[model samples]
Each structure stands twice: as structure tokens, then as C-alpha cells.
Target: MGKAAKKGIFLTTSRFSHEAEDYVKGLDAKIILIDGERLAELMVEYNVGVDPVATYEIKKIDSDYFL
Candidate 1:
């Protein structure tokens, strides 16, 4: 647990009990909890499983355009 103070802790689960949350919060370590839904979101956000099929770009003006 003391090591958490240095490296922190991350817990990913489908659900968390109030008691568990309270216990971790009471610890001096920095604890992060990510539920199943959030874990999935993070995976998608980071492109964990999906493949990059295509790319697109939008035209925008640069400072030179103004100049």
C-alpha cells in the first residue's frame, strides 16, 4: 500500500462496492477506479482494439494565410 504513494494504484472492474471505495480512499495512496463502462470507453479512446481504416483532414488557415 505504501508503494501506492509512490506509483499510485489503478483498479478496473465491472463494479465497485462502497466499502471498497471507502477503504481505498482512506489509504494515503492515490487510487484510481475505472469501472467496466469507463474501461471500455478508455480502450476505445486509446484505440485498443479497433483498426485504422481511413483518415480525413479538414482545411484550415495558418498564420501565413493571414500574413
Candidate 2:
């Protein structure tokens, strides 16, 4: 078969596992982390739009990088 499409989700900085549980429910997606606060802060870090979704929190997901 051809290459499978990849999907993903993201975590807002300052957010622990407790708050992230809701959005991380049954769906499967990659978690992109917002490393810091303020638009200028995250903007210098990531190359994506950092808006309301980029709240002050964080979440984690598994990956093959460890294996």
C-alpha cells in the first residue's frame, strides 16, 4: 500500500495531564507542545499559528523516537 496519512494533536504550555485529558479523549493524533507563553515566545519556537489553542498548558503522547 501507499504511505499512510499522518494526523496529530497539540498541547498548550502550563497544562498538566489533568486538564489535557478531555481533548485527548478517544481520538488519535500527534501532540504538538506549546513550549512557552505569549505569541512572540511560541512564535520564535514553532512555525505554526499560536492562538487560543495555544493555552497555558501541556500534554504528552507516545512516539517511536524512544524505540
Candidate 3:
């Protein structure tokens, strides 16, 4: 099988225990663990299930305009 078929993604609203993490380390298949905090960050970054309420921009006054 291809590498894609040998990989797994495990997501949890909570975190995995240290033992669980160590167990996967020795496994042949690649596994990605995504916990609560990281899951929220990913959602925001990808705009998966989030909405932007507002946007802001900062501006600097041009000194040349005054001259």
C-alpha cells in the first residue's frame, strides 16, 4: 500500500495520555495526534467552522503629506 494508506489521524476533544503517545511511537504506521487546543487552532486557521466577526487595519500618518 501507499504511504497515505499507512497513515492515520486521531483527533480528540481531550488529550491523549503519555502511555498512548509512547505506544504509537514504535508503531510502523504513521499516526498524527490532534488534541483539543490544536484542533481549535486548526479550525480557526482553516476557517473550517469559524466566522470572522470583524476586521481591523492600522494606518500610519504620512509626514510628507504635512510638508
Candidate 4:
């Protein structure tokens, strides 16, 4: 046998990418870009049951604004 395909939380808006197709097809997470706080909420809403990997790339708000 061969190695199984790695599974991950695929996020995408475009229906073209394989990730997007998987997400839209309910095979993966449909990641819609949003604020950290908002993203957390959505994760909960979707019952992901895990902490999102926070990155500056997604939350571009200035540190000052976070306060």
C-alpha cells in the first residue's frame, strides 16, 4: 500500500482550487477570511472543536487596534 493522503483544514473561496472544491463539496473546511475573533466564532459555529492557527497573514489589524 501507499501513504494515505494527508488531511488538513482546507480553506478557500475560489471554486477552482482543489482545496476550494473540497471545501465547497463539504469534504473540507470552507475557510472564509475574517478577523481573528470572527474566525474563532465561525470555527465554533462549524464545530471544528479546535483552536485556529493564528497568523498575521489573516489578521492584519495593527496591534494597537486589537486593544
Candidate 5:
């Protein structure tokens, strides 16, 4: 995949160095850099490698319904 690939995703548990970040800016394709913190956030957000422990919903008295 040469010119056909216009976008890419790079995931790392650590981080991207300043030089590595700067290099992608000059490239023809778009590159997304995901660091450790963000990777964890995305994993939780998308339910990847995770399990739902508990969920709760709050309810209030409906005066209109009572009336």
C-alpha cells in the first residue's frame, strides 16, 4: 500500500518523541499518534479489553404523573 494508503494509526503504550512527531507532519499521508494515556482512555471508552462492573440510573418522583 503505497499511495493508496492515505491515513494511518500508530498506537504505543509509551509515547512519541518530538522528532518522531515532527517527521509525520511532513509526510504525504495523515498519521495519528496515540500515546499511553489516550490509549487507555480509548480502551475504556470503546469497551475494549474491559468489562462492565456496574451501572446505575437515578429516578425522581414525577409530580405530573401523580397529578
Candidate 6:
């Protein structure tokens, strides 16, 4: 783990639980735990191993628009 950390290999797993998260938080190495949902979201966000077929524009509500 120390060697991997020194080499800048960021470890990530989707099987992290609350206890595991707490344990990893105490480690000196860089580790990221992406749960199932977040992993899916990231895959979609980065287009990893998947192709995006459509795009959408999202708009936020502006208070000034009503004023």
C-alpha cells in the first residue's frame, strides 16, 4: 500500500461500507471509495466504457427573472 501510494496509485473500491470508510480515512495513503451509485454516476459523467447518445441543457431558476 505504501509503495502504491508513493507511486501515486490512487486506490478505489465500490464495496466500501461505513466501517471501511472510517478505516480508510485514517490511512496516510490516498484512497477513494466510490459506492455503486456514485461509480455509475461517474461512469456516465466521464463516458467511460459507454457512449452518450443525447445531451440535455439544464437551467436554474433565477430570482431576477421574476423581478
Best lDDT goes to which candidate?
5
Off by over 4 Å in 6: 2-15, 55-67
Q: Candidate 3 lDDT, tens digit per residue, 1-67?
A: 2645678999998999999899878888888999999999999999989999999999999999999
TM-score of 4: 0.24
Candidate 1 positional error at 37, Å = 1.1
lDDT of each: 0.74, 0.52, 0.90, 0.52, 0.92, 0.71
TM-score of each: 0.58, 0.23, 0.76, 0.24, 0.69, 0.55
In candidate 4 the C-alpha lDDT for residue 16 amounts to 49
Residue-pair clashes per candidate, as listed?
0, 8, 0, 0, 0, 0
For model 6, residues 1-67, the per-residue Cα lDDT tens digits are 7356632323354466688789778887766667777777788889887897898999999999899
Q: Best by TM-score, which number?
A: 3
Total backbone clashes of candidate 3, pairs 3 or more residues apart or in separate chains: 0
Span of 10 residues, lowest total lDDT, candidate 6: 5-14
Candidate 5 colliding pairs: none
Higher-ranked by TM-score: 3 or 5 = 3
Pairwise lDDT winner, candidates 3 and 5: 5
Model 1 has an lDDT value of: 0.74
lDDT of 2 by residue, 1-67 (tens): 0344355545455554655655545445544444336445757568566445454667687677677
Model 2, residue 11: distance off in Å is 6.7
- As a whole number from 0 to 100, the lDDT of residue 59 in candidate 3 is 100
RMSD of 1: 4.3
Better of 5 and 6 by lDDT: 5
Order by TM-score, highest first: 3, 5, 1, 6, 4, 2
Per-residue CA lDDT of candidate 4, range 1-67, in tens?
0344334343333224555455546734333434456666777779677765674655566999779
